[model samples]
Target: MTSKARLIYNPVSGREQMPKNVADILDVLEQAGYEASAFRTTPEKMSAQNEATRAAKEGFDLIVAAGGDGTINEVVNGIAFLEDRPKMAIIPAGTTNDYARALGIPRDNIPDAAKIILKNKTRKMDIGKACFNKKTQYFVNIAASGSLTELTYGVPYEIKSALGYAAYLIKGAEMLPHLTENEMRLTYDDGVYEGKLSMFLLGMTNSIGGFEQIMPDAQLSDGLFQLIVVKPSDPGNLLKLMALALNGKHVDDPNIIYTKTRSLKAELIGKSEGKDLPVNLDGEIGGYCPVSFDNLKQHIEFYVGC
Candidate 1:
């Protein structure tokens, strides 16, 4: 029996590469001997996600997400909860192809990324479920909360496309001076922490924002999250820790909480008492915080480069 596949892409991501390379990508899928088709995401919210759901239900054996991390996250969300989800592939076309970077898939090359499907290399990737504000959202790369993390979505979409990773740097620098600590209670396996937190990251992969050292020990199929929590610190100390993170040496920092867990709960207390913190899911604002996270171990299968 011939396998079937669906390609879901964001037209404007990666400065409009998806549309231009559509034919080549489809050809690559064909070369891999799969019956293939494509779907273009619309301005209508959840477009990719809805399409992904439909395609998976229709019994496509493969789903190729050909845009940015947001597009991939949507595709994953569409079917990760299903009893029989399809295998996935990524064509990295975005400002910071964080997920692609982690997958060892080439970024900025649509057809080449699609061709990775032909290599027959694959893996089961862990997926994260975040629950907050009576809503559930899923993430495949990283989930974070804090003022600094706002940089993920704070950069305008248009600006991000044109400036790429530089846009995030600019935004980070601008927000650094104004950073504020939040009264936080973080609960994880074996222990709990109650203190001021500058930021916290739950990473399922080694790469984050184009840097791999932040979660150097992260493994896609580990069934665990590498949780990194930043304790409140002066700007100078915070900067120092960030520098250490670049080299994967921050794990021992006194102001950092680095551990592995299958689940976690992050609560905001005091000042922002009842206020909700925005949760960044795969670089998009997923929902508000006071959130709980659960790792679905090796929940989704995907074509990956070795």
Candidate 2:
């Protein structure tokens, strides 16, 4: 039986040169014996999740996402709802292919990635579900609250286009001076902790913001979620933590606290009591603080090169 490959790609990703690579990808897939078809994504059209869901329902053997983290998030969301999901692949066609990096997919070359996808070694990985208000969804990587969340919301779309991943650093630096500490009460399977914290990040994957290693101990298939909490500290301590994170050494830093849990609940406890502090899920800001996270064990499967 010939495997069918459906590609959902963002045309505007990767310096607007992503479409240029499609023909080559199609050629490679065809050579590998896949009945390949490509679809261009638009803002108003069916989302990546919708596309993936449709493909899986229509019995595509493989569904490939060819954008960045946001695109992968959608595709994962689509597959999460399927009873029998198709093996998913990544083409790493975005500016910061964070999910691709976490999966050890090569971004510099396209043909190699296509070849790997054709081979199709599927691995079952844990999925994280975040619920706030009436919105509840699944994330394959990190869900964060506080400063990083605010930064994600505050950064303009234009800046993201102009600077790529560096836009996050610039926006984060600018917001640092004015960032407010979050007074939150956190409850997890292990225990409960309450305090004023600079930021709270829960990771199912090792990295965040494309390159920052916020959760150095995170494993995608570990079946547990890793939580990193940054307490309210002196600016110097925060700076040191930031530096350590860039080097993937934040787990060892004294000021940063790391823990693993199957589930966690965060409630805001202060003057901004009723107000919702922005919470970022997989680099997209939408939910508020006081969010609950639960691990969905082996909930999703991916075609990984590693």
Candidate 3:
């Protein structure tokens, strides 16, 4: 039986090039030995995710997520929980395309990125499962919470499309002087950190916001997450830590809690006063704090560059 492929893409992402590239992308998938179809995501909330779930249920052999990281996250979340998840591929169209960078997939050319499926060099990928009470969500690369991380969320879409990671830097600087220190108890494989923290990050891949060394110890399928908890510091001290992070040596800093864990739980402490400390999952606001994450090791297979 021939394998069937579903191409789910966000039409408005980046330069909106997917519509023009659809035919070529499908041809590339066809050349890789599959009967492929494309689905342009609508604005009807979770459209990509819904289509992804439908395609997976229909027994598609491959589900190719084409667009920015957000689109990829939706697709992954749609099927990551399934017992029999289909293999995945990516054609990046977002600003930074951090996950694609980690996969060694070409970001500038959609067809070239898809061509990786033909190369057939891939491995099982670790999926991060974040749970809040009865609800669950998933992440493909980085999950973070902090004032600086939240700044990126408020940046104008036009600026994001125009400047990419640089926009994050610009916005982060603006928000630093008024940073929000979250009081949370963070539990990891080693121990617990309960105190005031400026931010915490859980990374499944090394690349985040176009910074390759941000999570240097991250492994794609190790069934572990590299967790970094930044203790509360003034703007100047936080800037210093930021510098250290660029070289992947920030783990050695006293102000930073760096460790690896298969599971992690983050809960608000007394200082929080029951207010929500938002959790940013793969660059998007996933849910409130009190989130528990389990590293779903080798959960999804993918088409990665050799």
lDDT of each: 0.88, 0.78, 0.88
- After superposition, candidate 2 runs with Cα above 4 Å error: 151-167
Give candidate 1 regions above 4 Å deviation.
none
Residue 286 in candidate 2 has what lDDT? 50
lDDT string for model 3 (126-189, tens) is: 9999999769999999888866677546787798888877887787777778888878898898
Cα TM-score per model: 0.96, 0.90, 0.97
1-306, model 2: which lDDT tens digit per residue? 898988888887766666888888888778767899988888974478788888889998877888877788888887876788877778886666777788878877766776776675778889898888787878888888876566555667678767877887777677677767777899987888788888888888776766647777778887799988887777666666667778778777766779999999999897657866878877787577678888988877777878
Better of 1 and 3 by TM-score: 3
lDDT (Cα, tens digit) per residue for candidate 1, span 78-135: 9987899999999999878889988889886778888899999999989999988688
- For model 3, what is the alpha-carbon lDDT of residue 117? 89
Q: In model 3, how many backbone clashes occur?
A: 0
Q: Please tell me which predicted candidate would have the highest TM-score against the true structure.
A: 3
Quote the lDDT for 145 in model 2.
Answer: 86
147 Cα displacement, candidate 2 (Å) = 1.8
Question: Which residue pairs come into collision in candidate 2?
Answer: none
